[model samples]
Target chain A: EDQVTQSPEALRLQEGESSSLNCSYTVSGLRGLFWYRQDPGKGPEFLFTLYSAGEEKEKERLKATLTKKESFLHITAPKPEDSATYLCAVQAGAGANSKLTFGKGITLSVRP
Target chain B: EAGVTQFPSHSVIEKGQTVTLRCDPISGHDNLYWYRRVMGKEIKFLLHFVKESKQDESGMPNNRFLAERTGGTYSTLKVQPAELEDSGVYFCASSRSSNQPQHFGDGTRLSIL
Candidate 1:
Protein backbone atom coordinates (compact mmCIF):
# COMPACT_ATOMS: atom_id res chain seq x y z
CA GLU A 1 0.00 0.00 0.00
CA ASP A 2 1.16 3.54 -0.69
CA GLN A 3 1.29 5.73 2.39
CA VAL A 4 2.71 9.10 3.45
CA THR A 5 3.29 10.02 7.10
CA GLN A 6 4.53 13.33 8.46
CA SER A 7 5.88 13.78 11.96
CA PRO A 8 5.51 16.54 14.57
CA GLU A 9 1.92 17.16 13.50
CA ALA A 10 2.48 20.74 14.70
CA LEU A 11 5.60 22.82 15.22
CA ARG A 12 6.20 26.27 16.69
CA LEU A 13 9.34 28.29 16.15
CA GLN A 14 10.60 31.70 17.17
CA GLU A 15 11.90 34.16 14.64
CA GLY A 16 15.26 33.12 13.17
CA GLU A 17 14.70 29.60 14.51
CA SER A 18 15.80 26.77 12.29
CA SER A 19 14.19 23.34 12.17
CA SER A 20 13.34 20.45 9.89
CA LEU A 21 10.09 18.57 9.22
CA ASN A 22 10.02 14.88 8.33
CA CYS A 23 7.91 13.10 5.76
CA SER A 24 8.28 9.35 5.49
CA TYR A 25 6.56 7.43 2.75
CA THR A 26 6.05 3.84 1.57
CA VAL A 27 5.10 3.15 -2.00
CA SER A 28 5.39 0.49 -4.67
CA GLY A 29 7.24 2.56 -7.27
CA LEU A 30 8.24 6.09 -6.42
CA ARG A 31 7.82 8.42 -9.34
CA GLY A 32 7.85 11.74 -7.53
CA LEU A 33 7.63 13.30 -4.07
CA PHE A 34 6.14 16.77 -3.64
CA TRP A 35 6.20 19.40 -0.91
CA TYR A 36 3.44 21.98 -0.53
CA ARG A 37 2.60 24.87 1.81
CA GLN A 38 -1.01 25.68 2.55
CA ASP A 39 -2.41 28.76 4.25
CA PRO A 40 -5.58 28.93 6.24
CA GLY A 41 -8.73 29.15 4.07
CA LYS A 42 -6.72 28.73 0.90
CA GLY A 43 -5.52 25.87 -1.26
CA PRO A 44 -2.03 24.44 -1.14
CA GLU A 45 0.91 26.16 -2.77
CA PHE A 46 3.63 24.14 -4.48
CA LEU A 47 7.09 24.14 -3.00
CA PHE A 48 9.41 21.50 -4.44
CA THR A 49 9.30 18.18 -6.24
CA LEU A 50 11.97 15.54 -5.64
CA TYR A 51 12.32 12.63 -8.00
CA SER A 52 15.18 10.52 -6.64
CA ALA A 53 17.02 9.82 -3.45
CA GLY A 54 19.91 12.14 -2.57
CA GLU A 55 18.28 14.90 -4.58
CA GLU A 56 17.78 18.32 -3.03
CA LYS A 57 16.10 21.63 -3.89
CA GLU A 58 16.09 25.01 -2.19
CA LYS A 59 13.98 28.15 -2.24
CA GLU A 60 14.56 31.18 -0.05
CA ARG A 61 14.74 29.99 3.58
CA LEU A 62 13.46 26.51 2.74
CA LYS A 63 15.39 23.45 1.58
CA ALA A 64 14.07 20.01 0.71
CA THR A 65 16.10 16.82 0.73
CA LEU A 66 14.94 13.36 -0.17
CA THR A 67 16.12 9.86 0.70
CA LYS A 68 14.89 6.43 -0.32
CA LYS A 69 12.44 6.20 2.56
CA GLU A 70 11.86 9.79 3.60
CA SER A 71 12.18 13.51 2.89
CA PHE A 72 13.01 16.51 5.02
CA LEU A 73 11.91 20.12 4.71
CA HIS A 74 14.52 22.31 6.37
CA ILE A 75 13.40 25.74 7.45
CA THR A 76 16.27 28.08 8.19
CA ALA A 77 15.56 31.36 9.99
CA PRO A 78 11.81 31.19 9.61
CA LYS A 79 9.52 34.20 10.02
CA PRO A 80 5.95 34.59 11.12
CA GLU A 81 4.92 34.98 7.49
CA ASP A 82 6.15 31.41 6.94
CA SER A 83 3.47 29.94 9.14
CA ALA A 84 1.33 27.44 7.28
CA THR A 85 0.50 23.75 6.99
CA TYR A 86 3.11 21.90 4.98
CA LEU A 87 1.96 18.87 3.04
CA CYS A 88 3.91 15.98 1.55
CA ALA A 89 2.60 13.85 -1.29
CA VAL A 90 3.90 10.89 -3.30
CA GLN A 91 3.15 9.67 -6.76
CA ALA A 92 3.62 5.93 -7.08
CA GLY A 93 3.98 5.21 -10.79
CA ALA A 94 5.87 6.11 -13.94
CA GLY A 95 2.63 6.86 -15.71
CA ALA A 96 2.03 10.50 -16.47
CA ASN A 97 -1.34 10.53 -14.72
CA SER A 98 -0.55 9.02 -11.37
CA LYS A 99 -2.68 10.38 -8.56
CA LEU A 100 -1.05 11.79 -5.45
CA THR A 101 -1.12 10.07 -2.04
CA PHE A 102 -0.93 12.80 0.59
CA GLY A 103 0.01 12.80 4.25
CA LYS A 104 -2.00 14.36 7.06
CA GLY A 105 0.37 17.38 6.94
CA ILE A 106 2.38 19.27 9.58
CA THR A 107 1.20 22.66 10.70
CA LEU A 108 4.04 25.14 11.18
CA SER A 109 3.79 28.25 13.35
CA VAL A 110 6.57 30.77 13.19
CA ARG A 111 6.35 33.55 15.77
CA PRO A 112 7.92 36.92 15.17
CA GLU B 1 -1.25 33.66 -15.45
CA ALA B 2 -4.57 33.63 -13.72
CA GLY B 3 -4.71 30.87 -11.12
CA VAL B 4 -7.44 28.26 -10.92
CA THR B 5 -10.82 29.70 -9.91
CA GLN B 6 -13.79 28.15 -8.12
CA PHE B 7 -17.23 29.65 -7.62
CA PRO B 8 -19.18 30.14 -4.39
CA SER B 9 -16.30 29.86 -1.94
CA HIS B 10 -18.81 28.48 0.54
CA SER B 11 -22.11 26.66 0.27
CA VAL B 12 -24.69 25.41 2.75
CA ILE B 13 -27.46 23.05 1.75
CA GLU B 14 -29.87 20.57 3.22
CA LYS B 15 -29.55 16.82 2.79
CA GLY B 16 -30.84 15.33 -0.48
CA GLN B 17 -30.37 18.67 -2.24
CA THR B 18 -28.23 19.04 -5.33
CA VAL B 19 -25.19 21.28 -5.43
CA THR B 20 -22.85 21.98 -8.29
CA LEU B 21 -19.29 23.25 -8.01
CA ARG B 22 -17.36 24.87 -10.83
CA CYS B 23 -13.67 25.11 -11.62
CA ASP B 24 -11.84 27.18 -14.22
CA PRO B 25 -8.30 26.04 -14.70
CA ILE B 26 -5.56 28.27 -15.97
CA SER B 27 -5.85 28.91 -19.66
CA GLY B 28 -4.19 26.26 -21.83
CA HIS B 29 -3.77 23.86 -18.92
CA ASP B 30 -4.80 20.46 -20.18
CA ASN B 31 -4.83 18.58 -16.90
CA LEU B 32 -7.49 19.32 -14.28
CA TYR B 33 -8.08 17.44 -11.06
CA TRP B 34 -10.76 17.24 -8.39
CA TYR B 35 -10.00 16.55 -4.73
CA ARG B 36 -11.94 16.61 -1.50
CA ARG B 37 -10.88 17.01 2.11
CA VAL B 38 -13.52 15.89 4.54
CA MET B 39 -13.49 17.14 8.08
CA GLY B 40 -10.67 15.54 10.06
CA LYS B 41 -9.47 13.61 6.98
CA GLU B 42 -6.69 13.81 4.44
CA ILE B 43 -7.40 15.33 1.08
CA LYS B 44 -8.44 12.56 -1.30
CA PHE B 45 -8.44 12.46 -5.10
CA LEU B 46 -11.83 12.36 -6.69
CA LEU B 47 -10.97 12.32 -10.40
CA HIS B 48 -8.81 13.72 -13.18
CA PHE B 49 -9.64 15.21 -16.57
CA VAL B 50 -7.38 15.68 -19.52
CA LYS B 51 -9.12 18.29 -21.62
CA GLU B 52 -12.70 17.12 -22.03
CA SER B 53 -12.00 13.44 -21.37
CA LYS B 54 -12.14 11.64 -18.10
CA GLN B 55 -8.73 10.07 -17.69
CA ASP B 56 -9.07 8.51 -14.25
CA GLU B 57 -12.15 8.55 -12.05
CA SER B 58 -11.36 5.49 -9.97
CA GLY B 59 -11.23 7.61 -6.86
CA MET B 60 -14.78 8.86 -7.27
CA PRO B 61 -16.80 7.62 -4.31
CA ASN B 62 -20.03 6.69 -6.11
CA ASN B 63 -22.44 7.36 -8.94
CA ARG B 64 -24.06 10.35 -7.33
CA PHE B 65 -21.08 12.47 -8.25
CA LEU B 66 -20.74 13.52 -11.87
CA ALA B 67 -17.97 15.65 -13.35
CA GLU B 68 -17.80 17.15 -16.79
CA ARG B 69 -15.49 19.42 -18.75
CA THR B 70 -17.31 20.64 -21.78
CA GLY B 71 -15.42 21.96 -24.81
CA GLY B 72 -12.21 20.96 -23.14
CA THR B 73 -12.42 24.14 -21.10
CA TYR B 74 -13.85 24.81 -17.65
CA SER B 75 -15.22 21.96 -15.58
CA THR B 76 -18.09 21.31 -13.19
CA LEU B 77 -18.74 18.76 -10.44
CA LYS B 78 -22.32 18.01 -9.56
CA VAL B 79 -23.34 16.13 -6.47
CA GLN B 80 -26.90 14.89 -6.66
CA PRO B 81 -28.85 14.07 -3.53
CA ALA B 82 -25.95 15.34 -1.50
CA GLU B 83 -25.42 13.57 1.78
CA LEU B 84 -23.94 14.66 5.06
CA GLU B 85 -20.83 12.71 4.24
CA ASP B 86 -20.37 14.85 1.14
CA SER B 87 -19.80 17.93 3.24
CA GLY B 88 -16.19 19.03 2.94
CA VAL B 89 -13.77 21.27 1.14
CA TYR B 90 -13.58 20.60 -2.60
CA PHE B 91 -10.40 21.65 -4.31
CA CYS B 92 -9.67 22.15 -7.99
CA ALA B 93 -6.22 22.07 -9.48
CA SER B 94 -4.65 22.28 -12.93
CA SER B 95 -1.32 21.92 -14.68
CA ARG B 96 0.04 21.97 -18.16
CA SER B 97 0.41 18.21 -17.97
CA SER B 98 -0.20 15.46 -15.48
CA ASN B 99 3.51 15.26 -14.67
CA GLN B 100 3.72 18.96 -13.87
CA PRO B 101 3.15 20.65 -10.53
CA GLN B 102 -0.52 21.43 -9.99
CA HIS B 103 -1.76 24.90 -9.02
CA PHE B 104 -4.80 25.02 -6.77
CA GLY B 105 -7.68 27.39 -6.18
CA ASP B 106 -9.22 28.50 -2.91
CA GLY B 107 -11.36 25.45 -2.21
CA THR B 108 -15.15 25.54 -1.90
CA ARG B 109 -16.35 24.77 1.59
CA LEU B 110 -19.52 22.72 1.50
CA SER B 111 -21.65 22.25 4.58
CA ILE B 112 -24.59 19.87 4.74
CA LEU B 113 -27.49 20.20 7.14
Candidate 2:
Protein backbone atom coordinates (compact mmCIF):
# COMPACT_ATOMS: atom_id res chain seq x y z
CA GLU A 1 0.00 0.00 0.00
CA ASP A 2 1.21 3.52 -0.69
CA GLN A 3 2.08 5.36 2.52
CA VAL A 4 2.88 8.95 3.43
CA THR A 5 4.48 10.09 6.67
CA GLN A 6 4.87 13.67 7.82
CA SER A 7 7.28 14.84 10.47
CA PRO A 8 6.82 17.22 13.42
CA GLU A 9 3.16 16.55 14.13
CA ALA A 10 2.80 19.99 15.70
CA LEU A 11 4.85 23.15 15.28
CA ARG A 12 4.74 26.59 16.90
CA LEU A 13 6.46 29.61 15.42
CA GLN A 14 6.66 33.32 16.08
CA GLU A 15 5.40 35.66 13.41
CA GLY A 16 7.91 36.06 10.57
CA GLU A 17 9.65 32.84 11.59
CA SER A 18 10.67 30.41 8.89
CA SER A 19 10.63 26.65 8.88
CA SER A 20 10.01 23.58 6.73
CA LEU A 21 7.66 20.59 7.05
CA ASN A 22 8.66 17.17 5.73
CA CYS A 23 6.65 14.43 4.07
CA SER A 24 8.18 11.04 3.33
CA TYR A 25 6.43 8.49 1.17
CA THR A 26 6.65 5.01 -0.33
CA VAL A 27 4.66 4.12 -3.39
CA SER A 28 4.74 1.68 -6.28
CA GLY A 29 4.86 4.46 -8.82
CA LEU A 30 4.36 8.16 -8.23
CA ARG A 31 2.00 10.07 -10.45
CA GLY A 32 1.83 13.24 -8.34
CA LEU A 33 2.43 14.70 -4.92
CA PHE A 34 0.03 17.29 -3.55
CA TRP A 35 0.17 19.87 -0.77
CA TYR A 36 -2.90 21.33 0.92
CA ARG A 37 -3.61 23.79 3.71
CA GLN A 38 -6.55 23.26 6.06
CA ASP A 39 -7.93 25.60 8.67
CA PRO A 40 -9.90 24.71 11.76
CA GLY A 41 -13.37 23.39 10.86
CA LYS A 42 -12.68 24.01 7.20
CA GLY A 43 -11.76 21.89 4.23
CA PRO A 44 -8.32 21.68 2.76
CA GLU A 45 -7.27 24.20 0.16
CA PHE A 46 -5.00 23.31 -2.73
CA LEU A 47 -1.44 24.52 -2.58
CA PHE A 48 0.89 22.78 -5.01
CA THR A 49 1.36 19.69 -7.08
CA LEU A 50 4.87 18.35 -7.60
CA TYR A 51 5.09 15.71 -10.30
CA SER A 52 8.78 14.82 -10.38
CA ALA A 53 11.90 14.97 -8.35
CA GLY A 54 13.78 18.28 -8.36
CA GLU A 55 10.51 20.06 -9.05
CA GLU A 56 9.46 23.02 -6.95
CA LYS A 57 6.47 25.36 -6.67
CA GLU A 58 6.08 28.59 -4.78
CA LYS A 59 3.11 30.65 -3.63
CA GLU A 60 3.47 33.70 -1.42
CA ARG A 61 5.41 32.56 1.65
CA LEU A 62 5.10 28.86 0.83
CA LYS A 63 7.50 26.87 -1.32
CA ALA A 64 7.08 23.18 -2.07
CA THR A 65 9.92 20.99 -3.23
CA LEU A 66 9.92 17.32 -4.12
CA THR A 67 12.54 14.62 -4.06
CA LYS A 68 12.34 10.97 -5.08
CA LYS A 69 11.42 9.82 -1.59
CA GLU A 70 10.09 12.91 0.14
CA SER A 71 8.65 16.43 -0.20
CA PHE A 72 9.15 19.59 1.79
CA LEU A 73 6.91 22.60 2.39
CA HIS A 74 8.95 25.62 3.38
CA ILE A 75 7.27 28.60 4.94
CA THR A 76 9.21 31.87 5.06
CA ALA A 77 8.32 34.80 7.26
CA PRO A 78 5.03 33.27 8.22
CA LYS A 79 2.23 35.25 9.79
CA PRO A 80 -0.52 34.32 12.23
CA GLU A 81 -2.92 33.90 9.35
CA ASP A 82 -0.65 31.19 7.99
CA SER A 83 -1.52 28.94 10.89
CA ALA A 84 -3.22 25.78 9.64
CA THR A 85 -2.74 22.07 9.09
CA TYR A 86 -0.42 21.22 6.23
CA LEU A 87 -1.38 18.02 4.46
CA CYS A 88 0.75 15.94 2.12
CA ALA A 89 -0.84 13.43 -0.22
CA VAL A 90 0.54 11.16 -2.93
CA GLN A 91 -1.23 9.82 -5.96
CA ALA A 92 0.21 6.53 -7.15
CA GLY A 93 0.16 5.13 -10.69
CA ALA A 94 -0.96 6.80 -13.89
CA GLY A 95 -4.53 5.59 -13.85
CA ALA A 96 -7.16 8.21 -14.32
CA ASN A 97 -9.05 7.29 -11.16
CA SER A 98 -6.07 6.93 -8.87
CA LYS A 99 -6.78 7.95 -5.29
CA LEU A 100 -4.60 10.01 -3.01
CA THR A 101 -2.78 8.56 -0.02
CA PHE A 102 -2.41 11.22 2.62
CA GLY A 103 -0.19 11.71 5.64
CA LYS A 104 -1.50 12.46 9.11
CA GLY A 105 -0.73 16.17 8.52
CA ILE A 106 1.32 18.75 10.42
CA THR A 107 -0.43 21.35 12.54
CA LEU A 108 1.22 24.77 12.37
CA SER A 109 0.51 27.60 14.75
CA VAL A 110 2.11 30.97 14.07
CA ARG A 111 1.92 33.44 16.93
CA PRO A 112 1.77 37.15 16.29
CA GLU B 1 -16.69 28.98 -8.95
CA ALA B 2 -18.64 28.00 -5.89
CA GLY B 3 -16.26 25.12 -5.13
CA VAL B 4 -17.56 21.84 -3.69
CA THR B 5 -20.38 22.14 -1.18
CA GLN B 6 -21.76 19.66 1.35
CA PHE B 7 -24.96 19.82 3.39
CA PRO B 8 -25.60 19.31 7.10
CA SER B 9 -22.39 20.73 8.50
CA HIS B 10 -22.80 18.47 11.50
CA SER B 11 -24.87 15.45 12.60
CA VAL B 12 -25.09 13.30 15.68
CA ILE B 13 -26.77 9.94 15.98
CA GLU B 14 -26.65 6.63 17.80
CA LYS B 15 -25.11 3.52 16.33
CA GLY B 16 -27.47 1.59 14.00
CA GLN B 17 -29.18 4.78 12.85
CA THR B 18 -29.06 5.80 9.23
CA VAL B 19 -27.50 9.02 8.01
CA THR B 20 -27.25 10.55 4.58
CA LEU B 21 -24.77 13.23 3.54
CA ARG B 22 -25.02 15.24 0.36
CA CYS B 23 -22.53 16.98 -1.90
CA ASP B 24 -22.78 19.26 -4.89
CA PRO B 25 -19.58 19.49 -6.88
CA ILE B 26 -18.37 22.53 -8.72
CA SER B 27 -20.45 23.12 -11.82
CA GLY B 28 -19.18 21.21 -14.87
CA HIS B 29 -16.76 19.10 -12.88
CA ASP B 30 -16.82 15.49 -14.06
CA ASN B 31 -14.83 13.97 -11.27
CA LEU B 32 -16.15 13.73 -7.72
CA TYR B 33 -14.57 12.06 -4.70
CA TRP B 34 -15.46 11.16 -1.14
CA TYR B 35 -13.01 11.13 1.75
CA ARG B 36 -13.08 10.89 5.51
CA ARG B 37 -10.84 12.04 8.32
CA VAL B 38 -11.10 10.41 11.69
CA MET B 39 -9.91 12.25 14.74
CA GLY B 40 -6.13 12.26 14.91
CA LYS B 41 -5.87 10.36 11.62
CA GLU B 42 -5.04 11.16 8.04
CA ILE B 43 -7.73 11.88 5.51
CA LYS B 44 -8.59 8.71 3.63
CA PHE B 45 -10.23 8.27 0.25
CA LEU B 46 -13.57 6.49 0.21
CA LEU B 47 -14.63 6.50 -3.40
CA HIS B 48 -14.65 8.34 -6.71
CA PHE B 49 -17.25 9.16 -9.33
CA VAL B 50 -16.85 10.12 -12.96
CA LYS B 51 -19.96 11.52 -14.57
CA GLU B 52 -22.36 9.47 -12.49
CA SER B 53 -20.29 6.31 -12.77
CA LYS B 54 -18.37 4.61 -10.04
CA GLN B 55 -14.83 5.03 -11.27
CA ASP B 56 -13.28 3.58 -8.16
CA GLU B 57 -14.52 2.50 -4.76
CA SER B 58 -11.62 0.51 -3.40
CA GLY B 59 -11.41 2.61 -0.29
CA MET B 60 -14.92 1.97 0.94
CA PRO B 61 -14.69 0.26 4.30
CA ASN B 62 -17.72 -2.02 4.00
CA ASN B 63 -21.15 -2.71 2.57
CA ARG B 64 -22.82 -0.49 5.10
CA PHE B 65 -21.82 2.54 3.06
CA LEU B 66 -23.47 3.47 -0.21
CA ALA B 67 -22.74 6.40 -2.52
CA GLU B 68 -24.42 7.68 -5.63
CA ARG B 69 -23.90 10.53 -8.05
CA THR B 70 -27.07 10.71 -10.06
CA GLY B 71 -27.24 12.87 -13.21
CA GLY B 72 -23.56 13.65 -12.75
CA THR B 73 -24.28 16.79 -10.78
CA TYR B 74 -24.81 15.98 -7.13
CA SER B 75 -23.90 13.02 -4.94
CA THR B 76 -24.99 11.42 -1.71
CA LEU B 77 -23.43 8.96 0.73
CA LYS B 78 -25.60 6.96 3.05
CA VAL B 79 -24.36 4.95 5.98
CA GLN B 80 -26.76 2.42 7.41
CA PRO B 81 -26.33 1.00 10.85
CA ALA B 82 -23.42 3.31 11.38
CA GLU B 83 -21.00 2.30 14.04
CA LEU B 84 -19.31 4.40 16.65
CA GLU B 85 -16.15 4.09 14.63
CA ASP B 86 -17.90 5.91 11.81
CA SER B 87 -17.68 9.11 13.80
CA GLY B 88 -15.55 11.51 11.82
CA VAL B 89 -15.62 14.27 9.24
CA TYR B 90 -16.80 13.27 5.76
CA PHE B 91 -15.53 15.46 2.96
CA CYS B 92 -16.45 15.75 -0.69
CA ALA B 93 -14.17 17.01 -3.43
CA SER B 94 -14.30 17.59 -7.15
CA SER B 95 -12.04 18.46 -10.04
CA ARG B 96 -12.31 19.24 -13.70
CA SER B 97 -10.38 16.09 -14.50
CA SER B 98 -8.44 13.33 -12.83
CA ASN B 99 -5.12 15.15 -13.10
CA GLN B 100 -6.43 18.41 -11.72
CA PRO B 101 -6.23 19.47 -8.11
CA GLN B 102 -9.50 18.72 -6.33
CA HIS B 103 -11.36 21.39 -4.41
CA PHE B 104 -12.87 20.25 -1.10
CA GLY B 105 -16.00 20.98 0.88
CA ASP B 106 -16.05 22.09 4.50
CA GLY B 107 -17.15 18.55 5.40
CA THR B 108 -19.96 16.97 7.44
CA ARG B 109 -19.05 16.09 10.97
CA LEU B 110 -20.84 12.86 11.94
CA SER B 111 -20.81 11.66 15.48
CA ILE B 112 -22.16 8.18 16.17
CA LEU B 113 -22.74 7.51 19.80
User: Which RMSD values do the candidates have, in order?
Assistant: 0.8, 0.8
TM-score for the first chain in candidate 1 comes to 0.97
Which residue ranges in model 1 land beyond 4 Å of their true spot? none
What's the true lDDT of residue B109 in model 1? Answer: 99
For each candidate, the alpha-carbon lDDT, in order, equals 0.94, 0.95
Docking class of 2: high
In model 1, the number of clashes is: 0
User: DockQ scores for all the models shown?
Assistant: 0.78, 0.85
* Residue A111 accuracy (lDDT) in model 1: 88
Tens-place lDDT per residue, model 1, A1-112, is 7899999999999999999999999999998999999999999999999999999999999999999999999999999999999999998865665688899999999988
Tens digits of per-residue lDDT for model 1, B44-109? 899999999999998899999999999989999999989999999999999898878888999999
lDDT value, candidate 2, whole model:
0.95
Clashing pairs in 1: none
Error of 2 at A22 (Å): 0.4
